[model samples]
Target chain A: MSADAGTDADAGADVGAYADTETGADTDADANTAPDATATAAAAATAPAGTPPDATPWRRLHPLSLLVTAQLLAGAAFGAGVPVGAGLAAHIPFRAAVAWVLAGSALLLAGGLALDVLRLRHTRYRVGAERVELRTGVLFTTRRSLPRDRIRSVDLTAHPLLRLLGLVKVRIGTGDQTAGGESPLQLSPVRRAEGESLRRELLRRAGPAAGGSTEGRLAALVPRWIRYAPLSFLTPLLAMTGWGAVMQVSQWFGAEETVVDLVRDTFSPLPAGWTVLALTLLFLSAGVVGSFGTWAEMWWNYRLEREPDGTLRVRRGLLTTRSISLEEARLRGVDVVEPLGVRLSGAARVDAVATGLSRRDSEENDLSTLLPAAPRAVADEVAARVLRAPVALTRPELAPHPRAALARRLRWSLGAALVPVAVLLLLAAALSVRGLAYAGAATAAVLLPAAALLARDAYRSLGHGLAGPYLVVRSGTLRRSTVALRRDGVVGWTVRQSLFQRRAGLVTLRATTAAGAQAYAAYDVGEAQGLRFAEEAVPELLAPFLVPDDGAVEQPAERTCPDRWSPVRT
Target chain B: MQVVGIDREGRNRGPGPAGLRLRPPHHRVDRRAVAWWRTRLLLAAAVPAGVLAVLGALLGPARFWLLVAGAGVAAAGLAAGLGLPAWYYRVHRWEVTDDAVYVRTGYFWVDSRIAPMSRIQTVDTERGPLQRAFGLAAVTVTTASAKGALRIEALDHEEAAELAEQLALATQKTPGDAT
Candidate 1:
């Protein structure tokens, strides 16, 4: 490709290098493991007849030894302690047990060393037209075959040692294991160049995965995703504000007399206002730090790439770098998450949920984060690339409506302060006006402003959009959440015309995806549209997986469920 | 031959296309039977948790159940979870092919995984007391993933090691497949 074409492709996005090549030198450290003389000889003999005699063999995946050795050693240490304690506490002679323990340790160590060499020598990986096959084992050799098309996600990770060796490990996560068994295929101690090449092959094998770069001009407004690390203070900031208000309310009402008594014990010369200011500063400082952790926990190094097969490749990491590739067809939906900062500054974070991934579970949420830095338009471009559809985000469907949002906040604040107000009123009836003063101050400042902000933020954060097979619902004030379910992918969608939503002309839409189900959120859209979207998403995503009912006899209503295993299978 | 984990049949299989296949005569296991057993084993892995939950609920009222259940589940879960790893050893089977490796493990959750020659990173073997008693060994093959590489287990140790050696060499023998 010419520079002009490359420039056009990159446009506003940063495209420093089509590929990072300097890391090749760094990957050499781990490549220097003890060479296998046997493998070398065989490699020479096995050379194809027409090939040059001195052709260097492709680098074998470094066998996992020192790492496995460390694991076995640690496990053996526990074994050592148990037997020593047995010998000391019980009458049994520790000598035999200790010898056994030592022997076991030796075996484990040997296994580690042997496996390392074996890993280097045995398995050969080949990505064929239809699938990937792994063959290796001694007498009863084993081979595993996976259709490239069926892979859900190709996850990449690197331990500190692996990282030091400039090697990263990759896991092919297929949502099949019930016990959450570790993935069965891995290539550790891999050079970055080769690893990326394998990744490209998987994407090409699956279909092109595209995301992020399509925003045409949106890269200028949003940070160049690569130029950025990531900024996340939202979750923790929300936590602090909410928790701080709770602490303030507790101190003012529940522990008032005790605090008053303690204050009365202080030096008589100290002024009340000075004491309040000092306490406020201390409390706010703690709250700030507390909230920071919440945001820091989720912040990660995120980079989004457009794969050749039109899938979105998201790579993110904190300690252990992880990579997940999502096909546009696999995406449920897409939405631009706009905070107050985004709405004001024309910068927004884009997020989406793909099939079989859940963001509700905090564990899944860490893995589910798709894009964190792209601008609203850039996100729209990514939606086109990754989702293969473009959506123009509409004005948010604010909860309680915009006008009612303030009233809802006011009503909630009043309802919350009622008990304290009643107690103050009762106390006033018995002749103490100070309690009433405290209640009034607390209600006016903390409760009212806090409630109002929350309601407003909640309203601002809500949105819904429809683009082809996708039904996108956007919500959450800080950790902006957007759930996209492909209309075709839905297994079963339920439309609930409850007394409240039906009467209000609103409806709840719930749909089940490959992994589990998602429910209707509080969005201002009509139930008719929600139901319509569900109808679309059903055949869109589920067409491939759902085994059609081919005229099987329907059992009686009273019959116990025929298949006990359907839950996991489904 | 299919009933036993031992690929004792001298006609071992290697990966290849179904008919234009240069595949080494491979050992094909009873996948359905393996799946049936693996499902039970995976459930057994979680037996301790279920027992702890049931016991805790039965012994304590709602208030203390959470605490009791938590402790009981932790203990039972750890104790009973050996079913997964154990059954994994029992049912894990592999069939080598001309171009790639095929691994099938677990009784119920059958993993019919194929790692091609290009993508394979490592392969290793192990022998423990149980394997020693059975005169069997374990082989693990590693491939790259997002987090770390995955190590697919359940191989006939010595053979798997030798096979791995064979693969490492054949990887060079083949062209274009090695990325």
Candidate 2:
């Protein structure tokens, strides 16, 4: 019976040519019942007449995709039903409301399934000799193709349901950003084996093996690294989110007032200050747990490996596993990022400064992260290995900005810290509110010292220097980033001087590049020193625009040469 | 040749010494840019002022304050519209060398940019409606780096087109994917 079914499916391929006609619905129903059969049929029908039987043929996403889509829809339906059901129950019988929600969900599920069936039947992809192409859509069929050579990344991801069914979603990208932020090609829920083979086949380089002997695991998950989770900036945010969730849930049950009153009564006996501190501690502990869980989910089984062909692959995640591959040829440098909280705990993360890493991915998911928050030494070691530098590039002492830069930071920080206090005091005076005056003083007491400390840290963080083949720049107190960028990768320079900076003889020099943040700045360096640094960092690039002191003096008679023009006195 | 010497500290030291400094670019934008900027500024300011005046007449309680706000906005706009365009024309300068394009722009805050010809990816000429009316156009030279695009605003239309074409030719001669 199995053999008969297989042969019948192949035979159906010959008839499948007519499936695109008005009778597409009838063929689609067959696809819904026996998706594997239809998938094989589609492959056979799409194969060209003269091609060999075993030649690369069209393929369809796994049939279990329908189940995945159904599960997602069911989740959405459930979330929507609760609120809608409540509204209906308030106006009608509770039993009738429940019946209405069930009926709506059934209709929604049926409609979604029908659309997905059509999609499954129509969507077909083929890996040709020089290109990968996908043809899909029911009403307006679209064909998208990516050149095999230009293919930059082939990432595979699988959520719990897809993993259970031995399926994975394949995202093929040229890393060429299109107007709309969507992956160029997505083949969701392909067989795990097929997805793995596709990844290997697509990324297989043509030339001699690069990093051949060094091909092995570069880094793997260290169980102790989980200790850094609660130290992340996410902890405070998570605490706030937890509080919001509690409030929302209580409100939904119409017990918000009771919950608030209960909390008030519990804390009423204690001093207000103590109550605030205790509540904060309670929320923070909950946040610590939440962050730990999130960290585990994100970094579980994390492994960084260099493939034989020099492709760097990162495989991680617990419930939704992800495998991201990057070509070594595209890598420009790396960024050692230390958020304030993480830095305080002596840890940092490493992110790849590679070309074609999409801005959205980096912003949303930290997709370029090569290492999670780890020991500072570990981060430096990983960075050295990744960049193949003999010495750790980020370990060098950098040339600090002048004291004027520190003064500028202090001015800005103190000014910002004072604004709220000033506003509060003014309001107190105008409204004659004695409590407002005290509140203003309290705010000043907490903020003034903190602002000064941050300003000093920020000043200390501002540094730039050349290390071997890279230009290292460091800045920021809240989230300090020390980026070691390839000197060759720098495409241009932007030097800015505001009125204040001009008087202070300081300039902010920004090195513009195609990779990473696109620009890294050396803030508030001495004017001549910054220019000299830019010149030294990339020889001949800035030489034509600069005039040395002696050159300017000697060429004073050259009227047409702007290079002889004197410095603009403020 | 005439020399106006200034020291590193920005003191007018009367040609006593010379110090290393960035020279201003050679070419200034078209004089008509001043008029164009004034018109643009006035148009931008007029909307809010008109809205405030209308609201002052329509509303009863806030009429005096609204009218006063409208007058203040108009006065500030008038002063800026008259003074800023000329200052911008003085500050905005651009020069293209065989190896790179250099530009200096902005009045209150000065910005200078240099993009090497080898790194340039695209060169484009744009003429907005108002600029076209004044026979002016702007040239934008783009490098692979997002922040490295150089714009030379308010040039003679023909000159802008020629500059863009020249830049495109220069970029074509240089190889490597500009990244």
Candidate 3:
């Protein structure tokens, strides 16, 4: 299990490179069965009852999958043995402990391999006319089936080991959010050709392509985009992860204290401030390097293309390559996201706001991403081409929110900044600590201006506008996102006003859609302006409830009207 | 009722002298909703409060503080249980128009949702034990949007059923998958 976990971590860490070898496998699979896959799909669709069951019979995973399982088990045994051997060495002779560890590992490996072989023998899947079914297990068999029409996605992925063996994992998703974290259907370590054929057959649309001009390459990897990798929030997080990993490994080896002592001694000669500064610089540089490698691994050979059948396909990854297919018919909009660091560097990433693009746990493997962080112009261009809009919907100038919005942000920001400072000062007063007082003052000095700056930036980020057939909303400071949602896609409107907002005559309007993020808001706009915007964005939706404000009538007071009535005794 | 005086001809008059304003929805929730809310709140608060009181009585060293905390919780629960239900009843309102379902809810922070009839996917009536005991039911109008489900809580059970039927019929009249 530990060895399996280790390999899983290795596969997850550089999700891109897992499929370098699988590229050849994929192309070969396409070449072999491209036409056959389509023909079979057409036949299945047109004559479900006429086609013989043998034509689409239950298929087992490639025999090489057993080899893959055995190899993983062997690696796991070695991985588990070393730590156990080391622990045993302390209690017994080194040679004797080593022998015991080796024997134990061999026994464990044999047991694991036997179990996998049973699993391999039992597992079988078939693409039937109406449903795709998988049956697997020995004592307790589980048969799961997904209706063909309900199938939303057929993604193909290959980690390094699977890629090396010319196999890919096929995941079929229905976009249904089942409770209890039940995962979508998966067929792991299938021969690349079989996986390709299954994917093509499952995702084939019955109708003609939406537009012939819209099909083809939308975007490809630009090598220089790697420069923006270190400008993401992931860099600092990666640096911390790296530091933690080093500490954890050292502790396992019983050299944690030694390494800590070495570091302390090296920094002991410097002042505390210099030591802190130097450590920060060191960690930041390490993070920058890590980010660059991560970017390359994830975005290398990245390509976005619309298939002739109107399926948007994103194929990328340096090591463990992934191919994700999304039906263009399901796409409601696109989101152009710019994190604080990336925004400063003038780069943004584009994500699809499509129904059924449900992510499967891992944040790194976001299925909605259409383009990784790239030049802002390129991001806009790709977004425009993907939506087939005349110009980038995110380019138009949006209506600025009321000034009261700025006031609200300022109040919130300053209050948040002062809370810790106030706490420190109160502590200083209670404890009579002069140093704490100084620290509180210093904190106030730094945080106040920074908070004010952020408040201003956040206020500036607020804007909403209509572009062609889409309603665009732009907001956020730390991670700015400009979403362009189809006007017709909005299913409902939620208008909210807090006591503070009511006092300021402002409202936050959220446009609810079935696509990405579910609800996007136009935050803290003037009440009248917001109502007008909502009414205009989706004509006639909010018109009936809206009444002209005849100047003679004042806005209703916040307090409930005194017209109490008894409960109806139905 | 406040907005009934306005004529349909006035709708396209655009911005008024001051500005356009959203009129409150037509009907308030059934008055029994207050009792339902109070019962629910008290029921929710009872378990923790009872546990704390029991612990206060049993534990020696921490008895006084635990008892004080229990009393505080009970007091807060009582205050909110008595005061908030009426406030919520006053605020919550719902109306089903020909083209859309308009609902106004929330007490301190008011929220109004308008889901077009064309976009509604399903209409369901839910009756919990307490609600059933009170002869009331809640009507839920679900739109294609995940967050666009509008629940008109604490209506007469028959009224809720009728509303659901009306909404279902209105939705059925429109074409295309709501998404």
Candidate 4:
């Protein structure tokens, strides 16, 4: 053991020197913990044939990646250079200027190539028994070391250019939100096979607790699910973008004014109502096509499989392929998110309620999404499968809130509608803009009924109940979410009662959990019922606070008195 | 205090004093909290009052009543500000039990929170310059809840330290498993 520790120290010193060469000043304090040279040598020995025989455990990146990165940079610069060079040539001697531009482009590409080579040389990664370490930089070195035990995810991504060369970038992360970008050890442009094996080896845990061997295909891309893609909130957004693109394309062709004139001429021959309807149809159709194309690009070969190594892997994308593996142990439960339009079509998307999937990383959000918009039943089944449970937890019939909650929502909605009307009235009074009174009246007329309907929908959406180990809560109007959260995952409870809510005998019980949005609320429930629900959901956590409603002597609360829980000062 | 002593024995005795209001047995912080609040509130009010006084002076003798009105408002403001802190001091109370730390505070819209010992991630004590001068300290308890850290302010320095130690000891025993 002492000899092993001595060899480890020697390898550590070597790593420290290599790290110091790039950083040039600050010492890597944890250098003593660098993986042993013998182990790193063993890794290099097994690595592909052309690896240098040097004992420095610093392994360089795939050599072709440098050329690929340089070519990509040079191609982008060439595109940007052409127009400017052409414009400058009109001012100077065309031949000389063209020659100078060519020379400049060559220098730019050469500089980029040289920098990439240095960066590759400086970059080194070692997968030790306990942790994964990555050291990289040309000038400002960043050394990251993530513990193997804390490694929650390993994702492989290959953009079109890199994919053509059969290379992939590996992102090994601890799934810590506060660690930010520093937490992920990025090994850019490694050989595809090497990346895959590294992902597998690093994520492999040893325990019967790891349910690895029961591998099964949970869900695969259903081409029919593409039909639901257009029936989403993104459809309208894409439609707006389509309209923008039409104008932008015309502008690019230097015929924007002519196109606008042509559009006007076509519409002028029709009634205003017909013209509006025609334009709406045009945009909607364009949006439908756009959404279809986007869906194909995003989910073309999407496959969700439970791997033999206890990882829930999601592989998808057409042009730029992605393979993300999430440890099943980290997954708490699942959320079935249904936007208003999607919900109307009997579809919902399933999202994993897991730790380390912070919203800060857009990629994590994509990886956390277990299923795209699909039939409600399919989404529920996928959620159930992911949880390894027999029945769909979120599919339980939820206990609805009282009518007073609905009344409160309606009043709130009406008040919100009135604010807009009041704003329009003020605008009309101040500016005396044409048709101002009509606009104010129209706003009120439209918003009042819409708000009322939304309020009613919101009331209908409110519910909370227990489903085995899961505490299921459903709520929202425009975008309803039904979350089946693992009961043990809940860390604390927050009971809030505003003066108005208290007066109405309502209380909001918030279940504070580490996974999925941090806190989920059972909103505007009857105070007694809410307390009872909270107690039953957690058991013993809140049971001591309740007193029996019988006509008997009052028993004081077990821990904190009821008087202490009161929100009123007096 | 006497009522609390009687309540334990009266609890099982037929009907147990009907219509009697039950007050929490939570202990209030150091009385110096009133002074702390008064200074803080006065400091906050100074800028607006100064601006009003300046405006009154700028209006000149043609509207000398403006100066009188501004002075009256500033005086009223000061009086209310001073009185409000004292009222806040009276209401703000906290208690630390074996299982949880309970706090009741706020003047008009009072808020109460109970952070269970098992859920507490950290407990820290802070003493501002003014607080240091007054020999007062504040203890902040952080839980995994979205409401953020709960603070018990303006306790005597030594008492705050002792309370923090006790809370930390209780929290350590639970080994908070929030994440």
Candidate 5:
């Protein structure tokens, strides 16, 4: 691997200063390298701006990380049964076997460390004033750069192992979602402070003006907020996880029957109904405690603050902390999410409707969650502040869809419930299973009411209206969301009417935007009313289709089609 | 029990808006689109019908009536395939103005859309294997919209290309004011 950044002379000169710092080869050296790395950074900082682009010295990850990687690889090798398999094949004696295993592991660790050192030597990154560039790979080299101006987010994350080593990974992204490969610049296992500086440097937008009181703290971590955490759907999930863990561990001990017998014995004295009720209560309590612990671990020192550099930053976590920075300028609006149980407690969470947060795979998408579960009023207050509006649009009562929408929901839900009933009836007829008949009756009795209730809730959730510069749309029963989207942010409108919707005189109007999930819908609204709403939301976009609305017409059927869809008569 | 409104020339209209009747869409696709759709639809239906006919015949005399029904379905499918495309062609119309693209399509459940030019992300021409054989192509216009991309199909290859270029120009004129 070339230590020489020789191909680019100016960049090469900058890279030379880091050679001394990168050679911290021992574990003790690893602990001491934090100050040395910072000193090297300071010494190299004297390079002039005229040097080809914003090239700072090329630096590698901290040396301690190499040890961590080596340890992990050695563990993985053992887990793969490599050492045992090889030892057994060699027919090694008992005492010699232990030595052989130790020697083999030591050799594996040495090889892994040596390769990691080579990897570190080959990997070089420079944080330029305008761009952050990374060049890596020994066999297949890759040189990638991301413009600082395009940098959307800078996130810091540390898992348990890295946290133990006082190291964290820094991920810098350009906010472009469609890039297929490993496009983001990742600086793995940097000293905790180094990670902070990298985040500060990359996110520093222009120089912070002296004597400016631009910083505003939106919300700080409060212990009481943890109370709302247990109310989330995670509670039930965590309870199930606990039960599954108990079952799994017992099976591992080959005493699964004993565990099951113990559980059955505990509940044997109770009536059937009381048993179910008691079990449910037990699970709920367990779930509440479990979710609360998880919440604390995730958000121990939670803080949402606005930096002077036009960024909304969230810093939190107890064991493995994270600092996620979202550029304020890219923020479109906010969505106040209220899940059913949380809503009952009058609590909600605030999510930013910003560009570049559409990552579907990881919890990194939660980077835009400005506020954790809190009081509905507080969530609204924070949302309003984030969007810089007078008040949150979601607070307002949304205009309801027509009655036909409710009927449609009922029909759909009932149809879904009927499928199981139909199947159970068919099964009963074929096998003369009398129990199936009772089960079918029970299913219908329970499902029909539940479906009807959900349908009603769904109907109640549908609404859309404008709140200042924001267009507010609320929908969904299971995961009810009220989004305050910037009117200017909306790029277009898509009006759809299925055959059923048309017959019911309803249209689902969608406002397409680049922010959030790209579209927000006002489902099953009165057709003309929806059109007028769309026209009002963005006049330039939907005006031509309005048909003037003047009081004069020869044909009524043509009026129903709207100007855009009405067939042109020659 | 009845409501009447006076029209412009003093004619009484019953329980409806006195004005605002829209003019019917005038434009249609390329003439060859009808033939293209007919051939595709016929093949799609014919294959399924042939499979069903074979399956029914294999079931022997006890299910001889099923074979007859399968043959009857095949004939009906063939008839629909030959005629439905022409009817669909009459309903399928698209018109582009300075501001938006209006598409009226679908035979059973007619759907129409007015996609604004300002929101268009990219416009491209697509030629599937079969479309290429017919010397026809489809113009797809996409926005960041969740409805996915909208395709204007069965146009001459050159015409589709031209339409895509025009749409692209429109998008450039109204570039997204976002990151």
Candidate 6:
């Protein structure tokens, strides 16, 4: 909510210049106020080189332990829900609704607990000119340290809750994936004034920002900490706002229920409109709660900042404020994770694959996106920019295709809808016009939107431009997506045509990286292009994916030649 | 007519390499393959007869029993003719080297395809209870295409595993340059 800088030199204001590197909140004259946040900072500013430690030079971050307990608890809740949701979905008739609500509530509680854990975890991060060491990881205990020299960028983040806690998480990304996204160190919740000063210090170490940031790689870097809004609220809110009114009206008229009962008795079927509405609310509530619960944990302590040097910094932690900086060149690959619920709103998460450890271990779930529905353009721009290249499609345009709107589409959908009805009529079920109309409702509700979507999706397929050094493939039909490739950046390309596809003269294309293959499968494209892709995309796309299975690779020894497996030709 | 030659390791103990050679795989008639073929042929022949048998069963006191008998014989024949070959393909074994792995099996076709190791990119080891019964395993060496999937049937378990490891190492070392 507020800030301070360079005014108090008595505490160590001489080092004020470093704090000003990012914020543009700096001036030369005031040397006094900058070091007010820490006695160490103030002392460092004033002390001569010969100044020995008045006390111990090392500060122990172990004092903040409670926050970790909360993280462990949240992880436990996540693990528990894995079983509960899957286990409970099959029973109780309203099992889905009950399961979602229970899971959502549990997650919400976990989110609250996680904030406290993060707070305890935040106190351990300490930064120095030589190295920033962040210590976190519950079971697989880890302490990550990045030499300031290796630091590619510095990211500072703060959110409302972090502000409330008077703490922030500082992360220094070293273009490494070995240790998961845990910064070499965290500042844990440090004084707000001190956090910025420290961020500047890191930037000064990282050096000046230059270059008209390359094409295809810049993406919107979100603040690490912010308010967490549970996505569960939307659907429930919609149903309540929309269908809830319908239920309310039906209940008020009471006569509506009588009519329904009379019709149900005559038809001998249960017509429980209220039950249906309630079930809908239940699903929405659970989904929203689980999503919002995590949101609360994430945004409850989120802060994101765009650094002057083209690095997007994020800082977040409910209990332990986490800060991390990602520079343009500090990544090998970028991935978007779309959890099932997030997929409903067409949202995805983003993570950078760095060099050190694989992302599962190095990229802390901390610096990833918290959005429920970021567009494909945003994904493309972010991936391309962060990877330090033009994303082939930074800003994508939407094109609605008419492939499905033609006569064939209508015929097929109509045929699909009519098949059952026609079958019943043939069976002499006496499906009258009224009975046929009952079936027709399904055709309208189920088939119409799907047909519209099919057409819209075909329209949405943006043409791809495979130009640039890498084969930057930009294609998105519905939830628009552009997969950019550097021709030299892939490890290999696999093309396959199923029997049906072969008959249609089509093939599936996949680009494999050490991480895995990018499935451009089932895409309709020219065979010639698919054939050329292996030659063009594999070399560069697959380089990063090649992980030495524990560095045992050695040059093969020469043998006289007899022991070889021959090819199988049928 | 018998043929003799050195075993795979090139030990020259038999008839000094100037011996008669057996006909190539395609020319040889696999007993199992022929027997299976006959069964299928017989089943096809029974189709019209099956209807007659069923009719006879209905009219003649033996009814469903006659139909059942015919079907049972056809089923048994189908199983005998087909089961072994299916098992042969499923329970094959191999020991692939840099140039070729030996293969031997017969259900319908007593045939072996020894692919030179130079062509293989991956070697897979497969086993099952039937394979275990022989204390053996099947080694399959695969390239990047379906035409490249070569299977060698029935190798000693340890030998199969070692050969698979060797083939893997060989391919990894010289895949692009392998002649």
Q: What DockQ does each candidate score versus the true complex, computed on alpha carbons?
A: 0.02, 0.36, 0.40, 0.15, 0.22, 0.03
Considering only N, C-alpha and C atoms within 3 Å, which residue pairs clash in candidate 4?
none
- Provide the lDDT at A210 for model 6: 39
Top-down DockQ ranking: 3, 2, 5, 4, 6, 1
Write candidate 5's Cα lDDT for A22-81 as tens digits.
Answer: 332222432211111222334444534333433366677877888689769877767544
Q: What does candidate 3 score on TM?
A: 0.86
Query: What is the model-wide C-alpha lDDT for candidate 1?
Result: 0.46
Q: lDDT for model 6, on a 0 to 1 scale?
A: 0.44
lDDT of 5 by residue, B37-82 (tens): 8788777877877777887767776467776776777788789878
TM-score of chain A of 2: 0.85
- TM-score of candidate 5 chain B vs. the reference: 0.78
**TM-score to native of every candidate shown:** 0.45, 0.86, 0.86, 0.80, 0.79, 0.45
What residue runs in model 5 are displaced by over 4 Å at the alpha carbon? A1-55, A70-114, A206-215, A246-282, A361-365, A421-442, A548-570, B1-26, B45-91, B105-111, B146-148, B175-179
Cα lDDT tens digits for candidate 4, A420-521: 899889988899885787898999999999999999999999988888888888999788999998887776666666777756656677777666677788
What's the CA error at residue A379 for candidate 2, in Å? Answer: 0.5
Error of 1 at A86 (Å): 25
Per-model CA lDDT versus the true structure: 0.46, 0.80, 0.79, 0.72, 0.71, 0.44
* Residue A211 CA displacement from its true place in model 2, Å: 4.7
Deviation of model 3 at A316, angstroms? 1.0
Give the residue spans of candidate 2 off by over 4 A: A1-55, A178-182, A206-215, A250-253, A261-274, A428-439, A549-570, B1-19, B46-67
Stretches of candidate 3 off by over 4 Å are: A1-55, A178-182, A206-209, A268-273, A359-365, A551-570, B1-18, B45-67
lDDT of 1 by residue, A174-273 (tens): 3332213324456655665667777777766555244334432222222244222223344345546765665565453355566556656763466889
Residue-level lDDT of model 3, residues B1-179, one tens digit each, is: 01232232112223344366788876788888889999999988787789999999999999999988988888889999999999898789877777888889997789999998898888889999999999999999988777888989988888788778867887899887687
DockQ of 4: 0.15
lDDT per residue, candidate 1, B59-145, as tens digits? 656637654656655655455454544555444444444444544443443333444444454556666554454444455654322
True contacts kept of 5: 0.21
* lDDT of candidate 1 at residue A205, scale 0 to 100: 51
The 10 consecutive residues of candidate 3 chain A with the worst lDDT sum are A32-41
